[model samples]
Target: MPMPRRRLILWLATAVISTAALPPLYAQTPPPTVAAAADLKFALEEVAARFERDTGQKLRLVFGSSGNFYSQILQDAPFHLYMSADEGFVFKLADAGKTVDRGRLYAVGRIGVIVPHGSALKADGELKDLAAALKDGRLQKFAIANPEHAPYGARAKEALQHAGLWDAIQPKLVLGENISQTAQFATSGSTQGGVIALSLAKAPSVAKLGEFALIPESWHQPLKQRMVLIKGAPPAARAFYEYIATPAAQEIMVRYGFAMPNEK
Candidate 1:
């Protein structure tokens, strides 16, 4: 070959080798971290595992009370996604310009009155019975999450008041930091009973430890769980948020006793 032709071939070969040695244009990156409500621990774990399998993106979750998590996010907690048991916190973040997109409702949760397994409590247990139990000294202690910080606790208070039993039971109440911890109080037999999310009560851990009654929906407003993508969230985080609203995820939520927003 002529000199000019050989030089041209050599340049092309060098370029090809350099490109191959460079980092992959679409190399796999580590998955984003998500800050989620404690009540969602079990269900979200399953969802996250499934998401990893389907999308090849790992999920690192940090679970805590919705209120606490909200505070941390405001302090720049380094989470790419946020899932809250109540919509108010998500809206708070959005209003503060902390979120990338409008917050969306993910699930509706039911509140319940829970007692330890084989506690001689019958189904359809009413607030009157609870009050009578407390007054008669049959039940000395009751548990509820802290109303000032937990949405479940707020609902529990509303239910008790609506039933005209809040004032009567106030002295007997022991507060937990969050619904999961409140359920822990009842399930661990530390208290006679407590109010918790139906979804948490239906978990395997709770199922083995206690039974619960669905609270009357008329007592409190709907518990609408919501999610938001952070302002600088990566594509993977947005994709995961979208995945939570898919039919597959909705089915999982329903199986765990969470009501789909569109369901009657």
Candidate 2:
């Protein structure tokens, strides 16, 4: 026997009412991810902490060579913001439509040479000591970030080449994947000395282990560091991006030995 039309309509209405009573699904927002340069390891951590305290927003930092991060971002990595050691990388991303726009210059980096305590390279005579130690065969190895991909490494190479020391130092060089690792190689006593970002040398971990001398900015091109917000960045990322330019964040970078872009 066929069911009556009124009974069928009543059953359909009950099903619709039960479904409507259920809660609607809401999309959850993911935490912000930042691709940061290795030189920022300490400085960014300090700034991020202050940012969190002020804004109640937490951010995850992934540190590596800026050039490596550039290649990763090109591959569609899920970073919400990028803090590059080289401004060129940020500009390249903007040109590729990967970033929101040409980002702001956040800091200027400087390079320096660090010699660990108890090493043959003493701080009193500085570079002169390095020369003497090398001539006496007391200094056998030196570490530096790989110039092929790390901005600081490139600067370090430039400084050596400018001083007519590259040809001699090249053979004894121990390359690190990045500046932080280079500092480690020097401070850990794995190498006699290293040329690294001044910002890293100012970090307490490295400062206590070694003494560093400024490499004079004239030896190489300027390290104009910049940062950008990735396209479709979350609210937290955007907020943090703006916060980086604030006085508090800039002060942290200054404390870490970074020169403000406009401070001259």
Candidate 3:
């Protein structure tokens, strides 16, 4: 029964060849797809780049209004992860049984008033100069993201209302589809100024376009941001979800003007 040595050697050679042809375990991991709120456009890119460099993993980032992303995910968009400027959206997804687990708070965001260079709108005590400019007809237009979806826009509206300037500024206001576009409107000279995410104002490109003053946090509700893994996420997505909590990635977010979740 143990006499077929030539045939046994041939079988062993075939098995070795088949094993060599298979891809390595790491190569088989699918890349992650992430849906992120617009406020994260710059900061998240930096984090994703660093993650790629450190872990050899690539992430596909889709940026939009969190409300829009919420609607899309409900419709079964193929995202592996979701990061929202408002934690409420993540919680909503969890309530609907769309997330693998309860999300974690990532950062707290602040709103700012940005005025393009050479505009009469001075950084005069947050809303005072803006109110004055509007009253005097010196400010033709002001921009903010649409509050129906963008968390930053909702905060902006709340801040303006808290300052008692909402009614006066309403007529002159122009609304962007999202916070990133609101920053663009303010920076592109389409509007003299806008209320946008502080993190965007801190970005180098946006910073050079204008000067920004932080709107008091007391004026609006806290923008407690959060991130979650979608049900059936790939390994890369899980890795990224954990990685953003690491000190290195958290530092990058802090550098971009986001307050750590623990910060006052």
Candidate 4:
């Protein structure tokens, strides 16, 4: 071979070797993380597992009270999506320009009163009966999520007030940080009973511990759970947000005891 031609061939071989030594560009892409309400823990886990299986993209979930999650987002927590137990929180984030848009209402929750298994309480449990139980000392303590932070807690309080028992049982209330923890308070026997989300009450773990009474809808405003992509979310995050509203995910939400939101 001519000297110049041989030198060019050598340069081309070196370029090929260097290109082969470089890492794949897509290997560096990160998974999206979502900050969700604690009550959504089980349902979201199931949905996320399916999402990963189908798309090869993982979802990292951080669960807490909606109020707490909102505060974290304000301070720039590293989350790509937010699912709140109340639409009000999502709207607050959107109004403040922290969320991508107005948000999508994914579920409507019902509040309930739960008692530990074998507590000899009848299935037809009522707030009045709970008040009576408390007044007579048959039930010394009751658990509820903090009304200041949890939508379920607020609804529980409203139900009690509607039954004219709020002040009567205020002193006996044990406050949990959020709906999931409040369910724990009752199921773990830390408290004799609790007011919690119906979704939590329906969980296998919770069902084994007790029966729950659905709080009358007239007692409180609808519990509309909403989800939104965070402002500046990447494409993967936006895709996950859309995936959650698909029929498959909606079915899972219903099976987990969430009602569909009323159509506008």
Q: Which tens-of-lDDT digit does each residue in 1-264 have in candidate 4?
A: 556988999999999999999998767567788999988988888988888888888777888899989999988888999999999999998988898798898888888888887663433445777866866777777889899988889888898888888898888899999999999987777677888888887778788898888888888888989989898887878878888878888888898899877652
Off by over 4 Å in 1: 1-30, 118-125
2 against 4, candidate with superior lDDT: 2
Tens digits of per-residue lDDT for model 1, 71-97: 888988889999898889999988888
Predicted structure 2: lDDT:
0.88
Write the residue-wise lDDT of candidate 3 on 128-228 in tens digits. Answer: 88888877888999999999998999999999999999988889899988899999998888888999898898899999998899988999999999989
- The C-alpha lDDT values of all candidates are 0.83, 0.88, 0.90, 0.84
Clashing residue pairs in candidate 2 (N, C-alpha, C atoms within 3 angstroms): none
- Per-residue lDDT tens digits for candidate 2, residues 116-193, read 988888652225666676678987999889998899999888888887778878888999898999999978898898
TM-scores, one per candidate: 0.86, 0.87, 0.88, 0.88
Candidate 2's displacement at residue 30, Å, is 2.1
Clashes of each: 0, 0, 0, 0
Clashes of 1: 0
What is the C-alpha local distance difference test score of candidate 1? Answer: 0.83
Instruction: Say which candidate scores most in lDDT.
Output: 3
Model with the higher TM-score, candidate 1 or 4: 4
